[model samples]
Target: MIIVITRPDFFEGEAAKIAQLLQSGRADLVHIRKPRASQSEVEQLLFSIPTELYSRLVLHDHHSLAIKYGLRGVHLNSRNPEPPAGWSGAVSISCHTLSELSECRRKPYAYMSLSPIFDSISKRGYRSAFSADDIAAARSQGLIDERVMALGGITFDKITEIKEMGFGGAMILGDAWR
Candidate 1:
């Protein structure tokens, strides 16, 4: 799957246009990660998108809106490490280390993003935590699989490389937005 995460800051005037374009294109999922936005702001953003596209969105904050808006799922990050009690829809998270990935495999997530597979395009100086060799080794050891997606600095050119490294898919941010 090709997932696209929204930039943390709201896109002043182009948010709806960009989101609609992505929804009409190849993005399998769109993770809305507006960390500083209020619940009302998030609701407004959601309202701007067509209701038919609601099933393709995943909210990073105000998860209650997932049910309120009938979104595809909710993404757990540092802000929310676990799903609220009785969250029955799809849930996913970010794993920074092999250990976390291993643990996530035991959960019922649709997929998990294992990030910084390459230097971050959005975050300066955020280098990859694992090398190609490390990725290969992890795959060999059964740590990387179709449930773990590669994130960070992902461009069209890197998709094949990420697949070769045994990631299920790539999550596009900077590359897609650019």
Candidate 2:
């Protein structure tokens, strides 16, 4: 049940076909993280996906749009302190540390992303990265629960290690879908 979270920069060309392939594969979730995408663009992509795949679709930091379009939910970053109230859909937050994870625990998100399990090309500015041992320690410390997801530098090759570390899943950016 590997999940593939898509970044807009990595997925360009034949979006309809790509979306179909993404939905057809062994993906538990497909997070659409087009940070600057317009509402119309998002809707166009969302509607292209079949209703059966709706449960597996998640947006990036756009609760209003998700609600308006009847999409699954939104993924929030560290800056976003809280998910908007009244969102009944699944919400996921990105956390990089025990403190952030602790803060996230107070929120009502469906899951959390603990990133930098490996060095990441996407997050070039973040020098403080985590290893599997660090991730394990965080979990052991009770900073997060079993629903934590691994992000940042996660690839298909590392899926087994991620699962072994007791993470629920990994969020893909430049790896799986590319």
> Which candidate comes out best when scored by TM-score?
1
- The clash tally of candidate 1 reads 0
TM-score between model 1 and native: 0.93
TM-score of each: 0.93, 0.82
The top-ranked prediction according to lDDT is 1
TM-score of 2: 0.82
lDDT of candidate model 1 versus the reference: 0.85
Q: Please report, as a residue range, the 10-residue window in candidate 1 with the lowest summed lDDT.
A: 13-22
Candidate 2 wrongly placed segments (more than 4 Å): 10-14, 78-85, 121-128
lDDT tens per residue, model 2, 50-141: 77667667777555767776667777765444556777888888888768878888876688888766777566765537755676787787
lDDT of each: 0.85, 0.71
Compute the lDDT of residue 102 as modeled in candidate 1. 87
